[model samples]
Target: MDNTTLVDNANVVATPNGVLPLAASVELVCSSRTFVPFLFVFCAIYHFLAPLYTTPKQLSWILTTVASATMTLVSIPFVWDYVSSGGDVKSVRTLSSLTYATTRMFQAYLVSDLIMGSIYYRNQLMLLTGWFHHILYVFIVQICIKRAWTQIFCLCALMELPTFLLAISCLYPRLRSNVAFAVTFFLTRILLHLIWCISYLIPSNRTHTTGGSILPSVMLAGVFPLHAIWFKGCVKGFIKRRKENRALAPQAVTVDAVALAHATIPSSTSDSYISFRSASHNHPARKDYSLSTLHHIGYRLWPARKAIYSFVGLGRQTSS
Candidate 1:
């Protein structure tokens, strides 16, 4: 037979092999036809209330909270089953009610969020990453539902737990929440996801009975690195902030030291003041002062010199 005929025959042969029946059953109960209208209604309500929010971030918080909560509810039961089954690949290959609901809800949220983001925060969409992710997720979920790959989609959905935490951190800006989010993201989105994908793609598991395909594996492999890169950026940002705070702390101490020296200089004719005069007379040129004398003078004269130089510099800067 020719290529097309062979492909057609294979599909026809595969129809009775359980996937077709499951796909039909999932469609009958959880049809996209049923989902699209609900999505539209939710979007309408969101849009009507959008003006109530003072900022785009507030609106995002509400939407992300809804998505996160739904996914969390779905993931709890799904995860329990997977673990209880001893990480059996077959456990994830079958679609449960929980998985179906999670998939549909997430797809709907992505569609609504995409529209809301485009309309309210068009600049963010221009960044391409957020826009691409929403579109890609929606497309992937739709394909999975239609093709009886709901179990695989649920495996992907596990990443949403961390995504929810990330949204919480963004909305609240708490150090604890951000730390939790980062750790959860690393565990779920990076480590567990990598393990799951590897298990799914094992050569022994690629049989027709397993319903495995290269496309899902390739898509997941591509996503894994992107997630890693994003997590690395989060780590780098945290480190940068810490370094900035540390640098600022020393400068603050130096400023306080300078202020104290200035206060004390006018009150007393101390040894430091005498030393400054003796060194100035001996050196003549300020530049020619010896290292030891400079150090001695700086120990007492630094605060006064810093304050005077700062005042002079400020005056010059303001005048210019």
Candidate 2:
């Protein structure tokens, strides 16, 4: 009856209630049109905060970690609603304003990272892998949003859970040894992704009775292989790193955590730890992340601890 029949789903014109009146304006605002503006915005913000991190990598990690956490958290309620309602058609075909805004914002962030990484953090970016991944996501997210695949997009966003952990660990390498990252990565990216794909493959799946478009399904299935490949490589790398760590004796190749932090961390980050070792309690020269700081604190607390222990021993003897 309207442009609804004439127009395609590639634009955000179609909704559960038929053709949306402000669809064009809203789409333009929430679509890839914001990419350039967001790019400039993120670039300016990161440059402003760059001095705090000392390196593009650390700054980039801070942005991505926050973005990933935000997207994951924001998607949870929508995703939970979709799943709990048993894949209502409205949840899939209907695009909400919040989901649209969140998707576009995250897309802008990813686009900014790709462009900025190319110019500033080229050394940190993987040639083929990173480029292909970001490009694919940036391109696909727009299409998915346009086609109103918010539920599937939200489900896929859970994979970023691992990125939050890994990205934060870049600044704090001591937590890098934790197996939680690898485990979460495998669970979300590999196992959960595989299940989603299988459900998509199943015809007439009651549990996920949303859309049945082959193209969207194909697009989703495509990412599973990439996830699997990344997981495999991650596991191998984790194993190798652990083996190397086990082979080395304690502090054999390294000094204390402070020295290790200095040797490995960017100078900008380490120098910010002023009050860590300052005796005057004012801003004094000291490294916060170190073994000696732990020893110093423990040494200062030992007398009180001994006194408490002696009191407990005396109480126990009196009871006996």
Candidate 3:
């Protein structure tokens, strides 16, 4: 019985598949043995940058940053070794390419599974919180990314896009207040999903075929169009609300001014015109008082009250 394994850190053999094939050479180099270091380094960088948003505590930030940075440093050598291995897939020759490939792929899939599976675990959490919406949003993003039509470069850009958007919202006070900024964020996110779904539906290269997992891809595809409908509704609502507010705002301001005028007008005035003149201080009848009439009244009578008290033999009292 011939066994399959890597030899001399290069080449894979099926025991009976001939003394290692040249076509498998690239596969051997790319397998788990060589890929781990790079994968770990990439994961480390991600974790380091991960605490950037969700967590607000300083301690979590510091710990995650330090841990990720250290792991990243340690992963570098493993990456360099894999790179130098010269694309060989022999069990004993270069390194066990199969072992490395299998391990890393499993690790990646495991992480994905845990994340995807946990979404609907609790109904209460789903119904009452924004977490579900955000999770769905993320799912929409992933479906788009994994779609056949998406470019690898756009996937990279998508990964960085959230971080940048979060930073803009947090750092720039004006972005928080900006309706345009909010619309941009929503549209771009939808656009990403649309591009990904379209990419899957229409592959860039003619030779590529759908892997036949219709259920998952289709579900992901549906989200974008649904999102488009939702986005339109939001735009309509915003416009309607803005128009209503503009119509009501002037009336509200006028009502407020009228209320203020009524409150400040003296209740003792006998004539409406005289009262208006006194309150506004615009007419010549109120030339001596103006807006500081209350102040003038107090200043004029303050010293007379003191003199009257003094003549009554009342001594001045002081607080310690």
| Per-residue lDDT of candidate 1, residues 233-267 (tens digit) | 88998899889977776565455444434533442
Q: State which candidate has the highest TM-score.
A: 1
Our model 3 lands, by Cα RMSD against the true structure, at 15.7
User: lDDT tens string, model 2, 1-320?
Assistant: 55344245555466446765467646664555655676677777767766777776786576677678887897677557657878542344334666676677778787777777777777877756667777888888877777776656766777888888888788667777458988989888887777666666666652344455655557768887887887888889879987986676344424443342343211232232322333224312233325776566434423343345554564224555
lDDT of 2 at 100: 70
**Worst 10 contiguous positions by lDDT, candidate 1:** 4-13
Error of 2 at 137 (Å): 0.8
TM-scores, all models, native as reference = 0.65, 0.64, 0.34
Model 1 residue runs over 4 Å out of place are 1-32, 44-52, 93-95, 174-176, 253-320
Task: Point out where model 2 deviates above 4 Å.
Answer: 1-26, 29-37, 82-95, 205-210, 250-320
Q: Could you tell me which residue pairs clash in candidate 1?
A: none
Candidate 3, residues 1-320: lDDT per residue as tens digits?
32655554554454455555645555444544534554455455445654554533221223223332343343334334423654111111212333333234333332332232243222222332234444554444344333432222122123223324434445333554436534554744575455444544543312242344343346546555655665676678779989997787656645534443344333332343344444444332333333465355434323344444554667376798
